[model samples]
Target: MTALQAATRETFWTIGPVGKAAFYWLAAVAVLAFGYGVYARFAAYARGREDPRDRLSNLPGRVVSATRTVLSNENQFDGDLYAGVMHTFVLWGFLVLLVATTILGIDIDVYRPLAGESFWVGDFYLVYQFAVDAFGLLFVVGVGMAMFRRYRERDGRLWGKHTSLEDDAFVWTLFLLGVGGFVLQAIGIVGQPARADEAVSFVGMAMAAGFEAAGLTTAGAEAIYGVVWWSHSLLAFAFIAWIPYAKPFHMISSFANVVARDETAGARLPNVPADLDHTNAESLDDFTWKELMDGDACTKCGRCTDACPADTVGRNLDPRDVILDLKAYRESVVDDPVAGRRDSGVATDGGVDGSATVSDGGTVPIVADEGGVIASESMESCMSCMACMDACPVDIEHLTSFTRMNRQLVDEGAVDSNLQDVFQDVMTKGNTFGESQSKRGDWADDLEFEVDDARETEVEYLWYVGDYPSFDDRNKKVARSLARLFEEADVEFGILFDDEKNDGNDVRRIGEEFLYLELAGHHVETFADCEFETIVCTDPHSYNTMRNEYPEVDFAEFADDPMMPFDREEPWNADGETDVLHWTQVVEELVDDGRLGLSGNELDYTVTYHDPCHLGRYNDEYEAPRELIRATGADLHEMPRSRSDSFCCGGGGGGLWAEHDEEVKPSEERLREALEDTDAGDGIEKFVVACPMCTTMFEDGRKTGGFEEDVEIVDVAELLIEAMEAGS
Candidate 1:
């Protein structure tokens, strides 16, 4: 016979009857596995009441964003290289292996057909073998590194608390499963005596030699091959089944989560519906399924927790844990609908053996039971900084969810007595101070300009003077300065004066969703009668609420004016359309427009700016405020945590009113960072802040840190106005 014909015959012989049978069996198994996976996946979705299809239609855009995030080192730590490399390798290797597996399952000879007649199938086989082996090695190495980081490495700030034994065990099990699957495959390939020419399978050959030396005959070798193959298949199946119950569930959910990722960083909280009349909804209890599922999609990545001022300062509240608790509560409600029902008053065993009975009504305790799950303290720990919601990858409206639950507890007479008083104050006083509503416009009286009551007349801008800026004595300076900046800029702006109501951004963030909606609705109504082209505010919280949240009011046609004109519109270009601007931002624009001027002052003090959680992180207004500061010719010293990564002031989320343990005061920590940044021999004369809450915190922190006389806490608006006046 010819050499070519002989080679052809040998190739066919290698893939003889037994090989064909084995291939068909593998195909059947794959088909069944895929079918089962689809069923289980669908079932899980149905259980969660989540749609099986992509809710966000922008798949291509999402893919691009995800790719950018993975490639960028912006948010990730420098020490994550080893884990990052391993993760990337595993992801890419799995993708290639999946393609190869698909080809094998189809019974298509990829090496023979795709490579052409002259192409050596052996070479292709070697390539596949090497890839799998290399990937297997990487998978083992990566998993080991992750395990070490979780266990051996005592990095507290990055990893936070140590992982539980259960989590550690799961990680090791997954690692072993991967290693065994590859090792088994390698051994089975090498066990075939006729496959000796497949030189690329070096690992397999080594494994086969070990098996042979262990006294395995040809029949034994074949039996071992079948056993290993079955073991590998079962492990794969088990991994799939266990996915939903484990953190690895992110494998399936992360893709969808990324696709549905919010375009805006959620730094600005979304408004509750204002036009309640347009909807069939009657009360706050009538939340849609979408609203209900907001908390469930959290991956608990701790991005929010890391950014949270409260968490940074040692507050008991971890944003990630808060979302997890809400998710758990939601799951519990599903498991037993009667669990959350206050009317039932039926007590379950509290999931503990002879623990204290938790009644549906009356006061709920602040501390968790022995299991460390349910506690009012957990709810109170949140500062409503919106840092968690901003940093969340899954767009979990954690602040909103917590607020809703808090409201439910409070309404049902389940909250602490102190909290009840605070809520009552918020409800009656229009501010948490519990002062009369008539005091809302007291700050305006100190200003020289005529503060227009926009309630009766048409205005270019409706200034939302929030509770803090109006009532707080220190914050009153910010209010007065903003008014002066407006006058200097020649901008046609007016405040609601006494008519201004609470925007509810703070209250809602604090878990008082009901009060927030009500307050926001009233503000929306007050503005409905007024003709205004733009809504501007010094407070980022109020800005976020009026711009995003007030739209939830039920009245649709009452305020027919466009919220803000598009810059592209003719009228906007012609008349210079009014846009919402922070006081500092407006001052900066005026300086640029030559309406305002800065004085030449040798303000040689190096100043560090503290980003208000809402202003810098949420609203992306970091630059404007910084620019305003830089205009004063002060050396701008940036904190390690700045812009989107800025830490909270420990005064948000109603934390200003809530009591905190001395050990975990966020203000002290923030002040330390600011002080550290300005650690020159001369010392920082001024620590500039934009948000009123931040101003308050820094002032308190300065006093606490015993630097009250050394370092002065001042607002950016105050600085800008001062600079302009000095130049004048």
Candidate 2:
């Protein structure tokens, strides 16, 4: 009573010797089952190809970063605040409770049994007891939030066709694991031999006091406590065993996926180091082990689908379903990866022998028009905007998996007629519309000064005018305005003129792999002959490819060719990959440096900005355009879906090349949003866009959208130009 510094409990208190033995037996069985399920997943991974990106070069750093990310619950908070708060509480609460349980197990099994000393007592014991009690309540609250979000309030992000009976089971099990633990503790407290130290367990003490107040006599409490204790124990055991089989598999896969995820995944894509032509493979066997595991890692939370531009309107693609289907297929073929590892000729890089049939080992087709796990329609319907990737908490690279399937579709000539025509145009004329290569620089003809041809002269900037801005009349106007801005700023820039091609951005996304290679290779060769420091782009699509994807391409084979056009010793910027900057970025730089001189161009125009998916989400360059907008003295109002959640303009990933069948294309929906957001008491009826594709799609949206008559789509450069003139 005076100095009660030491406090602990028997591991199996009051449970008979036989009951203790039975508990150990159940624990052993649960551990074995959990171990087998986890091992089977790795066994499944062993069947896929090597992922070059899975380098362990910075193992310690990766572990530290992954640990910090997992512990902080940062990824979960990216877009949805409710989910973020809900998940943070659950994650931290569950982790604290888990750690407490582990310490108790270690104290009982290892520390006390082997060392004859306990680290499970005194201040540590009191603190541990308090933490478990507090976090147990927190865990229950989290489970309550999740259950309400899943069933009561029904969050759209937490529901879809992929949501199943197991989802309900996973949540209910977690609920019991938390709430039941507390109930068991309360009943145990009411009946157990009590001491002064027990008061530190505030929740249990309070519940025990309540039980006593309710006349829970020791005899009756003892009778009820045993059942509650055993039920809780069995539930925890089942929870452990079911982790790998149910939604809880995300606990393992999601963390690994996050740690291994490429920071620049959708933008740079995976650069498989083999003959990455994985077309002959029709099943999970074609996907790398990491990619196949991406399916398993998915939480089936439907967040990706919630963020999908394709799904936002009315498209056949559902990213959540795509991953779930892949996960189901992977479970079916878990044996195939294992068999392939045991001398079945599964290549190290996930490529298989062209002659070997994947189906021979139970792996089946993933994408097909008739019978497949992922419908061909879903794959094609994807805009490849990477909105799903940005939205995914687990870092599932949906685009990476979809890109592989799209390549297979291309191999089979499964592309639609509209896309096929564009591919042919890109192949023959080096532009999307089969436009003459000579006209690539026509947009600059009317500029105050001619943009120097990079082939003929050295320049500080090599502008990749891009296909749309160069070919499409509306965007060409934006191109000229940007060119005028560049000239006004005295920026030394040149372009390839006719030598410029489509840059193979959309071509790559459209699944014309070799064609993209061919087009990009042509530019690499031409750049070798030119002299420039940076490749400037007006199209975020082009900027994304050239800045991110192009350097990852293996041009050693192409560049080493004996007779490249305009023969050069090395590819452009051999000293380094040439810096790629979008015009808005460059314009911002110019304005910052006092190059684009202006004073009091304060046109108090309140305009909302449309963030292009590539610029905002893919590159995370949300502010560059916004800064330029403010530079023009416009008050920037953001749409509900701005920045990372920016609605797609329905012009990315070959969407511009194909017909949009939906009654309201994403571009149209986006326009409607812009109009609503900007209608604040006669706010300016113009919306600003930064990318060429955005301009193209939004211009069309302004033509056919519901508020077409009420709004105008202006490029960020055009608005800036308007401001400059206003100052003049």
lDDT of 1 by residue, 288-319 (tens): 33334454455444667766766666666676
Count of steric clashes across candidates, in order: 19, 4
- In the order shown, the candidates' Cα RMSDs to the true structure are 6.9, 4.1
TM-score of every candidate relative to the true structure:
0.77, 0.93
lDDT of 2 at 676: 64
Quote the positional error of residue 710 for candidate 2 in Å: 0.9
lDDT measured at residue 582 in model 2 versus the true structure, 0 to 100: 85
What is the RMSD, in Å, between candidate 1 and the native fold over all Cα? Answer: 6.9
The reply for model 2, stretches above 4 Å from the true place, is 1-3, 114-119, 153-155, 272-281, 335-364, 558-577, 600-602, 678-682
